[model samples]
Target: MLQKMSSVQPFQFEPEHEISEDENIEDVQYQINQNEDDRKVYEVRVGQNGWCLCGYCLPMLTGKESVCCKELQFFAVAVPDIPCITAHTSFEAVCLNRDVLWAALVSLHDRESADLSYRYASYRQFTWWMHVIRIRNIYSEPDGIYAGFEDVDIDYTEIDQAWRDW
Candidate 1:
């Protein structure tokens, strides 16, 4: 599994933080280009964990990462809670719920990368260790409608037993 995980290094970064406090980054397009890998639509880490999309909340997908697997980068998207989360997932939520996904870019893993560091894609972009995120608004699941980040159940613990099974 370790060998398989290292295979895809899909990510890229910007010289500095691309998301500016003034740019009004309300939404983020997870995939703007073409190809098979661009179709991945990632889900947010709900439950007791909140809207986290990295670390234990994130589960490594099986097979080649043709989409939103760890291969994609998470080096720029910044949340007040998580250090550097994925802007794509975060932005998607923002588009769905105004109080979601819209975060600012803090920094980048590489110094010579582009400004859109928060963008997700298959490349040399910086990936993240903290792959967790909390929801910013009310959410409805098969179980029920959660009020907000504070209201979610966050089913996973430090190591999501369910994610591990996947």
Candidate 2:
């Protein structure tokens, strides 16, 4: 596992005018460069937090917006040793932060729960480490359900673990 993101180098890139075969990918549910014959790509309009919600317009962009969801080139980033992030949007920087990646690979157990989002970078997270991570009050543990907007990340254990792992 990567000890720590040591450095972050954000660069701007767009899907090739004709995307290369290797560039096409399907991971974590987002598809890239499909229908090679069709030149058009899905237009991911910006919602409140800059993530695209599936078609029907959300009256107000409220939902758990995934920063690394393959389709965006925009999002924030946290760099090495330095406790900060920079969003290099427009085609490459998906909601990727150094701490989140570090924790998932180097610290987080395979089953450890976490909620990595741009929200962590917000001012609200200044006191975020005080809370404890717990199953949402809504569900019983081990239900195999993914937590969404249920205040799962209020606890900063995941973040703490990331730094420890680093």
Candidate 3:
């Protein structure tokens, strides 16, 4: 069994200016309106993967504009705290500011392949690989991901034997 707590408590007063009931009502209404407006504004949350719709594009998507740009950037520049490495890809290296992460991601997605003529598949493959590498690097740690690859040992005899067995 539990005892019921009393709802009433003794009030202590100190010297203070009194606010009128109407003034209090207005203040409360103002706070409520402000909160409502805040709710209407959309905010970007870090770590959530999605399109980086600019203010103008967002409004247009909602039928505010008859037509909107079909293309949008995907790669956001890496932030200082969130370090990136790009050695594996053709992109030598790229560092991002905290504000540019989203923009960078968008840019990567929107970037067009340079080999549009398709003279050689290798060219397209290389370009695509580089793009992917850049994206991967953006998510990698600052120290880098391939730090231990150089230390790996490879034996041609072992490889030949494994292939013969197969």
Candidate 4:
């Protein structure tokens, strides 16, 4: 199992922390400067411990990963063409409910090669962790009434679990 898990390549990206808590959704999108044509729509899904679309979340959902199986109370979506979005709540609750959505943009900075350095080690860098990005407005699910991010539930959990699943 360890070997199999190790075989998967983790998605690469950077975090966008420019969003201010007081900023409106439209401003947030403008700050990112992502064009609609370049933007991609990623369906939400449930992974192992929390709802996430990382290497761990993808394999564990298919019974391929078993080391840390736990209740699913989180959500995440990562696409090569768009920013990664995720949300989570406490596992002790009777039902999962998330009120916040965090976004991480793809990395635009990279070094030419890995070179050891005490002060400048090559590493994955994120400007911020779990930064909140506002949603413009509530959008309806495929077969349901209009709903906000906080209202997203099990209905959206299985949309794209097979993405990069091994």
| lDDT of the candidates, in the order given | 0.32, 0.35, 0.36, 0.31
**On residues 79-119, what C-alpha lDDT tens digit does candidate 3 reach at each position?**
12222222213122223344345434443342245553343
lDDT of 4: 0.31
Query: Which ten residues in a row are the worst by lDDT in model 3?
Result: 7-16
lDDT of 4 at 19: 60
Q: Write the per-residue lDDT of candidate 2 for residues 1-166, one digit (tens) a residue.
A: 3232223332322322444466645531244334332223223332443443233233333232323333332322232222123222311222455654554343223333344334343323543343324323323467756543334444454444554454
Query: What is the Cα-based TM-score of model 3?
Result: 0.15
Residue-by-residue lDDT tens digits, candidate 1, 7-69: 222222322234546554333232223323433332222223332435434343422221222
Angstrom error at residue 85, model 2: 11
Per-residue error for 140 in candidate 3, Å, reads 42
Backbone clash tally (model 3):
14
TM-score of every candidate relative to the true structure: 0.16, 0.16, 0.15, 0.14
After superposition, which runs of candidate 3 have C-alpha atoms over 4 Å from their true positions? 1-23, 43-166
Error of 1 at 130 (Å): 41
Model 2 alpha-carbon drift over 4 Å, by segment: 1-34, 38-98, 106-130, 133-166
**Candidate 2 positional error at 48, Å:** 32
Ranked candidates, highest TM-score first: 2, 1, 3, 4
